[model samples]
Target: MTDRELDEILTTRWPAVMRRVIGDDSDDWMQGFVKSIARHSKRPSWRPSAKQAQLMQRLVADLSAPPEPAMELVER
Candidate 1:
């Protein structure tokens, strides 16, 4: 899938779950956070705004669920 598609999914889902999981408000770290997310999503290019990137990071942290081993390995 394309990075844009992954962006849509992250933007749409990852934040609130991250909040619940980490008890931290990532709602303010969007800029570098988005870039960080793009790196993880393995996207070649994506420039989300600071607010947008923080949101993206939250989303990434949230929807990181997987079989079992991959559950807590999102940001390594």
Candidate 2:
């Protein structure tokens, strides 16, 4: 994916979840975080590392999954 797409996913799409996991909700934290990741890229266009992308995709999937049903108590 492009750098902008990655930025969108990390910043716009899942800021709340990202902030919870990162424990830093300050302004522009996500933008700085994304820039740090993108800084290591060797490509002409910036992109997250494969591992980073995979991890983010997993987060998206986990977030998108339906919640499990609550178990009913069987009190005698």
Candidate number with greatest lDDT: 2
C-alpha lDDT of all candidate models, in order:
0.53, 0.61
For candidate 2, write residues 2-70 as lDDT tens digits: 668676775655655554445644358554654455455435565666887886666666667887999
Clashing pairs in 2: none
lDDT of model 2 at residue 48? 62
Instruction: For model 2, state the Cα shift of residue 60 in Å.
Output: 1.7
Cα lDDT, model 2, residue 53: 83
Per-residue C-alpha lDDT of model 1 across residues 1-76, encoded as one tens digit per residue: 4467556665665444544435643455544554455456555454555675566555565456553564464675
For every model in order, what is the number of clashing pairs? 6, 0
Model 2 worst lDDT window (10 residues): 34-43
Model 2 TM-score, 2 decimals: 0.50
